[model samples]
Target: MTATAATEHVASWYAATANPAPERPALTGEIDCDVCVVGAGFTGISSALHLAEQGLSVVVLEAARVGFGASGRNGGQIVNGYSRDMDVIEAKYGARTARALGDMAFEGNRIIRRRIEQYGIACDLRDGNLFAACNARQLKGLRDHKALWERYGNRELELLEGEALRREVNSARYLGGLVDHSGGHLHPLNLVLGEAAAVESLGGRIFEQSPVTEVSHGEPVRLRTPQGVVRAARVVMAGNAYLQGVLPALEDRSMPCGTQIITTEPLGEELARELIPNDKAVEDCNYLLDYYRLTADNRLLYGGGVNYGGDDPADIEAVVRPKMLRTFPRLAGVGVDHAWSGTFLMTLNRLPQFGVINGNVYYAQGYSGHGVTCTHLAGRLIAEVMHGQGERFDAFAGIPHLPFPGGRLLRVPLSALGAWYYATRDRLGI
Candidate 1:
């Protein structure tokens, strides 16, 4: 996974239907810039885009291609807010911190839409997402969720149950659901690629297949790759899960987890519409949840299950197909066109960690499983910090992060056991 060895995009539906993009050259020599960004996924690209728009000299270095990590290989749902709810934040971090985060919870979605319109990035932009409930407890939770979001000034939500919920999901698996009118889904890879193009258009430089092997944090930060070096006044570590060896401090507090997805063959317009009447992205209420949405080509893209140590399942399809069948028994014999897995960084608290090291090197990671929107927000917050506005960023940085209790050797099994307990609770509906 290091930048020394070149890697291509994963063999997923997103890659198969990706837009034609030019191959960016790897860094060959030392380059100087105002800022050097590590990792060209959503956070790196988004941070670069925001800074470049401000007319700063920005350089991006990626271990592989742009959006090669969780950015490209995600559920693609623009689910707003953090992995933990606002109430959870309030309980742990105080009301002021909760208010600050709540205010910016949905800003990432706005940032995305603005980029789409400003740059004309076409990634099958759609509207609306549903949070499905599997039982009465979850159904009531969704009701409270609606009220909680509304309290935070998010009124673009509606609670639905019984026949009304069926109209949205068309599945017997869910007892009820809540819809986020502002939340939605899209082609994530294309979105990041388009944003990278926009970054270049703003005069930012991005080097693909350029892994930063070593980082010397001083007055002028130095990032070493196999073939070249980047010298800059400041550095932003946005590598998330794939970012290993360079900064063990960041890696120590986070664990990489893998999630698998499978896309079925195009079911035609009629069946696709029948499957999702409104075509909104759907995620069920569970400790380890299943999320799904329809692609522009009318295929049902379904994903679920997690491997705590970022280990790929023996057969991605084998792990996900049964879940798909359970959701839609009619698709028993549906041929899967693509199956893939992507790793995302997970923290014990299920909240992102943002901080500065040595007063110049900044980093944001550990979005847990709620990264699609948060990563973009992280970029904006990082940009604000670089611009000397640290109030908002401090709110996130103020939240403390603890390392996995079992450390590297035993962290996976310990986490898996904890997950099993909650998942069992979810199954029993207690």
Candidate 2:
């Protein structure tokens, strides 16, 4: 199976404001390395940086550009923990596994901060994230969530209610909220581009516009791109939803879901703070959630609404603008400057799928909306495994995942049905 080149970044507000990255040449000849990683998104770049730091020769191939996928076009919130949360992991994978996974949950944010400081990556980093609850039940859930996370060793949290909550968000929509001081947001594309530069500084190679077309099993696994081939002792597939059909097994274990984001014209400093008083990123508590934050230029970037079949909405603003208006009615007439969509891989259980294939082939996907931070943690784990340290990698790999049911013929419809059920539950204030 061959993966196709995306050719360019999606038309997003991020692209317009991104720090200029030098155009890199495509891979045109065969090369050998200690490790060959496919996909130059967060996971692949993070892994490449770590592997290079470990003194391993590394090369990364991207079907498009680095951060071209979800890594570049996401809500930007540094959400704490996995998408499934620690309680779910504890129930499904046992306490031991959950503890290990929990320990690493907040490390991604640390890694981001460390790298930003060490390499002087100017990505407009922020300091907090807010989880708002629409109803009383949801408020109680936030209270419970704070307690749960506290028990899991995440103590940098505060619960707010009534006026406190309203003051936090400057909106009457939420009855209460849970603020994680450890959680925040940043410029997604610039973060990845900076990491790519850091990887190059460490002698790691990255090939843009090079899509893998084949993977053959052998002592040195062989990977083929259109104009180049890579023969490495090990191969890692970190392409996520953008991997296309190159690897059937990974495709089977995950489904691509498209989500949209719309950025309004810059609100200026005063208006921006008037919308979100403290400038914290926020995501509401709902099955179909809406997440938003103020960009460095003061634009309100709001995103949500999922398409299970992975089809981009004909008009991104038509799908997302209403959600943004509903959240901040004061911005009803605000002009949207850019709109775009990106695909993310989701598993049945909403946990990331990590494991080995063909012995030396390692792949991790299905972050299920938690890709931002989890990808960094995953990269470190993969690099560690390559260096004869597999404890952390084994913990995540041991988790089980259910493949999409009914295959391609009915998996999407089935998933949509499930989504409808949960969305209804959310509407009813459950």
Candidate 3:
């Protein structure tokens, strides 16, 4: 997408109410740093912060302004765990690796809180999340997942049944749910922007409007942009879905998927409390999941709409408003103040992709819909590996990610075909 097209694509509620930051200069001349990061989303910024804090000279190049991608406009749920369930990981990688992965997933949430406190970021952090089951089968699945979590000795989950679930969420559509105190919500844009500030404070350079156009790997990696280039010993590709053709090897490993969200005009405290008395982020177990949370200002922020094709549908409100009303009919007539969409990178296995290409060029993406927390953990892991401490990073890198069938040109169609199957399964409760 062109720069203008990218700007037009971002009119999210988070952007509209984001905390202002100083404008940084665009890259105008060639520069060099110990580490050069491409794309200024959460992964890039967080990686830059961690590297800079360790006293490495780092420079970040953003295609657009900071917090201009999915990092800024996500559902804001700091969900604990990978996009793939723990059992899936255990089945694939055995119990030991699965437990390690599960512990890392929980650490992802803790890392975000630690950064918020360490940087004094004011992103309206909350401390609750609900995984609501749409049917009895899903409820049973939730119970099984809870049991596994307890077996692992990480039992921070509270099981809510029937009326108990209704008391917390005011939704009769769900049977029972799991409330996780460790998982919560936050102002996503604020968190990204704050991290960017923290990166700069740690003596890192961030250049906005500096889209990397070309990359060459040799003794020293080189990244070329429209106006400038960066040469460094190491390069980190943190572009995620907006990466375009920066790294062709990653193209087939992940596909860009669009997800939409809508926010209503602020509901008063009383009404907001009535909607979600516990102020928890709520999400259903459907293939096309419905996740919603109340903003710090009391607006109902509802998000769900996964499209394999990258196009952003014209009628954002039309597509997601009904989903919102299905859970909160009391807000049926409430005006939708904002509607926007973001592109998330999803892998075939629904797990994050972390590996080094050609040894020195590191890339991390494919968070699926579980990035709000995982990206932070990814940054830390990437930093640790860069500093010669690769234990945890190697564990994640060990998880293999297959290239999307049909390659780049046909992956979307292939994914769409697969999505249909899942959607049908969700509808049939099978």
Number of the top-ranking candidate, with TM-score as the measure: 1
Candidate 2 on 17-75: residue-level lDDT in tens? Answer: 89989788889988999999999899999999999998999999888788999999998
Per-residue lDDT tens digits for candidate 3, residues 206-281, read 9988788888997589888888989999999998998877788777788889999999999999999999998999
- Per-residue CA lDDT of model 1 for 345-367, tens digit only, reads 99999999999999999999999
lDDT of each: 0.93, 0.89, 0.88
| Model 3 local distance difference test score | 0.88
* Superposed model 3: Cα runs more than 4 Å off: 1-9
Reference-based TM-score of each model: 0.99, 0.98, 0.97
Residue 266 C-alpha lDDT in model 1: 95
**How many clashes does the backbone of model 2 have?**
0
* lDDT agreement of model 2 with the native: 0.89
Q: What ranking of all candidate models by TM-score puts the best one first? A: 1, 2, 3
Cα RMSDs, all models: 0.9, 1.2, 1.5
TM-score of 3: 0.97
Is 1 or 2 the stronger prediction by lDDT? 1
lDDT of 1: 0.93
